[model samples]
Target: MPGSFHGRLFPQNTIHLVHSSYSLHWLSQVPKGLVAESDLPLNKGNIYIAKTSPPSVHEAYLTQFQKDFTNFLSMRSQEIVDCGSLVLTFICKNDEEDGCDFWELLGITMNDMVIEGLIAEDKLAKFNLPLYAPSIKEIKQIIGKGGSFKLLHLETFKLKRDSNMAEKEEATLFDEKSRAAYIAGNMRAVQEPILVEHFGEEIMDELFERYGKKAIEYMKNYGKGIINNVVISLSKTN
Candidate 1:
């Protein structure tokens, strides 16, 4: 389940439709050549490419995303039937923001915890979240590179942080705690093992606890920053 699509072969020409939701933005691994051997830390005091990150850092991440996504599309094209459709709903990076801005703010909190002597600066440097949110144009290029899947439909949707926990009875009222819990749970499912692997078991509870609180504050202030997501439907053509 963890291997690259190129490495893990699927049954060729068996599948009809594929639906990938809230996945595929994650790279298979950390980008190589993050920093030169001679120079100091390229992304010092930060866990990811921030709004202030240098152009080289952004280039490194985009390059890696292109490679991994190309292979993913190529493999899927071989597995699906002719004219089979694939619907992918993934976070997009646009004029708005990545769906994972919570992660970005969390990283900043981690830096503050380091300043407070709660965590080691080196640990922060070693930990980089392997995530990428591609734009529609970038996705098109990836699919084009495979030369198998034809784009059928593409649409953009927004997810407001406050809207994640709306009640069925009343759309205006928000369940803040439930919203926080849901976001925290999803993040824990994806990131707990990684955090534990790097920072040990002790940091898990406190880290995500802070993350949940940060999520609340983030929504309160920035109002989800109008997170952008793209739903792309592609068809395999013979």
Candidate 2:
């Protein structure tokens, strides 16, 4: 995001309303401390922060998110007019996914690929998704500490990510094969740019292709992913 404020991207105190959904979870850049001074990767077997990750890796990610979100609020607050509103929607960490966590399944799939030599361990270590799902309390704390805006309303809801696909007629049901293709296509549209930039073109096709097949298997075994989506409306008082 470049932390642009009152500059070319956004002029100060001119914008009235801003809307964002499911995007703020993404960090402006990859979290640091993923690699040690020895140039060895700090987070070695998984993609994003995984359940088995060391405490340091977890702390590193949390620190990065705090820094990024604080800066984001600071920047945008300057561009907002008095009483201008910012409505943000984001995913959170919760047990609302039944027993299936999409991120965990994705991590397992990536780790499986590493085990099978489909992708190198170092590559996995080198790559960390620039994403962090903050809890609702953490979100409120960051906003409160930002000091430029006052939160007006907050709501959280959980829903199956692909429930409609399952509710369709048997003939129209999303089978593993069809579901894999669709999931890959949809996610690739959004993630491919950053992925390619990080992992390059050679790994892009193969990685997502493998991921899609694994994702289908995961869906069959665990149903769809569930998420706690939070919406927060805040007003700039200063």
Best by TM-score: 1
Give per-residue CA lDDT, model 2, range 1-238, as digits (tens).
4743222347788889988778788887788888889998777766677766788887888888889888878877888899999999888777353554666556677677778886677766788888888888788899888898999999888865455555668737556777677666766787788767766677667767777787777766776556678889999976
Q: Write the per-residue lDDT of candidate 1 for residues 122-165, one digit (tens) a residue.
A: 78876777777777788888888778888889999887644545
Residue 54 in model 2: shift from native, Å? Answer: 1.1
TM-score of each: 0.87, 0.85
Q: What's the residue-level lDDT of 159 in candidate 1? A: 72
Clashing residue pairs found in predicted model 2? none
Per-residue lDDT, model 2, residue 156, is: 86
